[model samples]
Target: MRGRLRGIRLAVPLLLSAAVVACTTTVPGEPVSQGRVISRDQPGGVDPKSVVENTDGGEIDRLAATVVADLRTYWGERFPETFGKEFTDLGGGYYSVDTADADAPEPPCTDSAVEVEGNAFYCPTADIIAWDRAALLPVLKDRFGEAAVMLVLAHEMGHAVQNRTGAGLSERRADPERFPTILIEAMADCYAGAFIRWVVDGNAEHLQFGHDQLDSALTAVVSFRDPIGTEATDRGAHGDAFDRVSAFLDGYESGVKLCSEMTVDNRTFTLSGFIDAGDAARGGNLEFGQIVESITLSLNTYFAEVAGSGWRQPQVRETEGQPACTPDRQGPVAFCPDGAAVELDVAEELPEIHDEIGDYATGTLITSRYALASLAAAGKPVAGPEAQRAAVCLTGAFTGSLFQREQQFLSPGDMDEAIQVLLHYDYVARDVDGASVETGFDRVTLFRKGFVSGARDC
Candidate 1:
């Protein structure tokens, strides 16, 4: 994983910053972008060109080629009108490499095939896009599905779009502030979001997306976000997960025009590469034990305000093995009405999940239970559809508190972890009957409401 991380730096396009305004209008009649909507008619993957090699007629290359083709078509038509200039297709075209093949030919802008391992990138000087078909695509496909792969390609093509504008590598080097790397990366991310919207709208000939895939695509994009605490001004900065998602959402909700209009003045990113000695010593994350204790104290303080003076801190019980809550309230963790306590299967489930996701995943689980307690204290039933929604909303509220940098600090990747858990499982969103929000799309939207506006919104 570390090696792959290192290769990412090598594979990505050189960086730049930008300045622009938000576009208020997009396509006709489609004033608002249709977020998380899938196309009714599916246009399968594209045909592979001769530049792609080492494929035994596999679908991955065809998919990449198809996405590339559609992207060029979208930009080719949209770019001229948006920028008042002719859009240029990648001069060097697309190249697919089988990094696993020792004898495989190296792609342009690379010294060796190994450089492409676990990565994909676009070379501005050469005006070409390339990928490690054998390594990167398959891994992303397995981890986040094919939409992720499309997103990667789309993001790179976004870079090509940037080059077509006036902010290519030479322009960025000329004026770093005018085209900083973070802003440049955000623009690409936004462009990818816009392109994905095009696909979702059934306009593309070879790509399709739905709400579930949208969540997964967001997940994949978050995974590639610069590490938490990375400064927006850093040379390699690509925006924090929050900033990246916000940009993507802007494009999805608005359109390509909004993506083209993004500027540093209008954007806010939470990640800061610089940290004080105290935080540096902790490596941007608290241990599992410390996380539990700190979150427990924080939740008690927060809900005290929400539930009035009557908010009672539930007794936290950590049991071995998986939680064995009654079928009426089944989940990895639970808030027991009978005992007025929160129960966690800490020994294996909590710790393992924490390790798999991050501290915030556990934090989200525990906080959701606390949310139920808050509902109960406020004279609200903890066993209805509304209660379920309230629970998820309160979890978002707590997450918002963390976002505000309250008593409990959010680790760099914590928000992304919260997003992952919410989308991956419904344990935190469930009601007494083990029912919760049916779609990750709605679940994340509600969470975002509380996260952006605070508990009052919930």
Candidate 2:
């Protein structure tokens, strides 16, 4: 997985800055978007052929047009409610380009349609949003579903909202340190999250969004994550997968108020460059066995010290296949209570994941069982949902601790690796009974709680 493309760079729409004033509103309103409500009734029947210029009115463009209309519904109410201003339509009309067609009209901020190929952007100067109907939207819809298209459009519209609120690109450039690009991008994500939540809450009129769609939304968002090793303070940096997801989740969980309130001082961005050139040369990954040895030792020290009195370290053993636990299958690894051993399959399974997702994926999986053992030692039951969640949380806590290590420390993309694993797998949140958390979102939430607040929060 080191060289494989895990996330697409599709998330980088042109980001200018934004600002806002205060307003008041209430929730508990009827929504018109799809999925939960499953509404197909369009308020005025959005026609991209007329509304968007240079359009073929193809399926992708039609979908994008619907997303734009829904954005109007959500933000028309949201903007005035949150920013104390009446919402206004874009001064510049939306544009759609058939990048595959040489005759397609050029969109704002680009000299030719070729430049906008496989891209979507909000041109701050022109106050317009444009997209490559031929490439970007279709691929997102195909790979991640309609919600991905919805979220991407929402994110681009978020740029317009930023400008409307007076935090336009000019303000961002005026105060780069205070309103860095990362924060701007995060705030935009948060706004998109707010829009998604609005739709999921059944407030949209032209789209459908449900609980199951969140995973697809997240998967799509992460694909747009910043290039590995981007510093949080870099002028053009968006953020790593974890940070980007965190921003989006914050918006989904909270609201525009919370998103608008984000500051460099208040937000936590876990993005940075490699500690050294040698570490970068190695791709910031330790060998499989070496990672297991190092993290196992760190886990023992971390749990022993954190759990304190009555916490006993468990033995680590490797097996060819599954562990010999009496019951319950813990994927490739298990914490055995009968013999007090953390057993794992070392022959094949782990090495593949190690090579596929980086060594830290294996390390994080191993860390969870170690966390389970610590839970058991602390007299906590190890066979329930609470235990499973706690173990995952502690795994995150331990991963966080690796940041400060003098040696065997976390590499630049380690947390992103952890994010990828937790987003795709449930093994980290499995208890001895094999019971697990219900969703990847919940598991990631628990892990994030631990990472942000440390083991104490877990």
Candidate 3:
């Protein structure tokens, strides 16, 4: 796990810097140059081929052009109606020819030679949506069928939509444990569905997916799901098949309102009364203990399936009468061989504690939303509508579980170690009125902004 962690750097695209705006420049004979294109205030270098190919590269290019144009038109009208703001066109930039040989370094615009497998990306850096012709094109033709090619464009364009809206910027410096990569990718998928829905409604003549073709499109989407939930982490944000399809359907069925509702936010939770009561008996805040117990239980269950039966509980014995080791002892003093009691020195233990446990807060956030919503729907007072709204803020933390899992996979350890790491932190909750809600551990801060007013205690 440590080796995996060492290799796992957050592959957040360079374009993820929220401050940088993508620039577009036109090359002579480019399609965007011919269109009613809105140029950026500060133009950056662009690949000429990207623009030229869309205008002149036959059916695929034409199809790509139409998709881009239609999405622009759709959102241009939709944004004003929904948010009372006009949509700004981020200039579509073109790519130049490849200077590298077949085996040499490939140009950004020459997608044909690039490796596309497991790499469906939107290059905000280039201001061009590129598909590795070497990889993705073949998959579209053979496995996903011809229509999928358009869907793929729509999906990539969906990311472009996020960029146009402020959502892309909001998600820029995403804390892996605090934000779920799956949701981000899923939102893009939903945006694609919204675009498709627009096509089905607005321009059926230009673009059409037959019932059978729709099935194929659905299958194409299902192909991207990660079988194991391990991929739920931030670096591996594309969700499992079930979540991917669900998000797409969420947008397809209900449209933008549902999609908007899907954005990540900070949510809060109260410690259960039982857990609080137990803490009262211990004469110390039980919040940390409760968190540890919950995490330990969850990790134990998780590892039991993934690591199998070889997973052993760490032996913790009472240290009251532990014998002092002799100088002749060769092994490190941390381990107690005879008594099986590990004396954890608090000062030393504090620093060695892996802050990774904060990852659990994200997981808890993810799992708790649905749990709270379900509770509210089923008449749980604490999770009722007002509280549910407050609870929704925690979504950012919950979705963050995906990112945490990636970190965990990188530095695999016993479940107890993971729990101990997480238990060191605290959960804070604040009321919607901006007053601190006291929980046993400490006054949990309300991290959410713009919450609805007049909500009762959560």
Quick one: best lDDT, which candidate? 2
User: Model 1 off-target regions past 4 Å?
Assistant: 1-44, 50-58, 77-86, 100-107, 111-114, 227-231, 239-243, 273-282, 308-313, 317-330, 379-386, 406-408
The digit string of per-residue lDDT tens for model 1 on 186-235 reads: 88888888888888887886666776567677666666666555666777
Output the number of the TM-score-best candidate: 2
Candidate 3: where are CA atoms >4 Å away? 1-56, 94-119, 174-179, 202-205, 227-229, 265-458
TM-score of 2: 0.89
Model 2 stretches astray by more than 4 angstroms:
1-8, 11-45, 326-328, 404-408
TM-score of each: 0.79, 0.89, 0.44
Candidate 2, residue 269: lDDT = 81
Better model by lDDT: candidate 1 vs candidate 2: 2
Better of 2 and 3 by TM-score: 2
Candidate 2 weakest ten by summed lDDT: 20-29
* lDDT per residue as tens, model 2, 217-269: 77777677766677777766778777888888889999898888888899878
Please give the distance, in angstroms, between residue 165's alpha carbon in candidate 1 and its true position after superposition.
Answer: 3.4
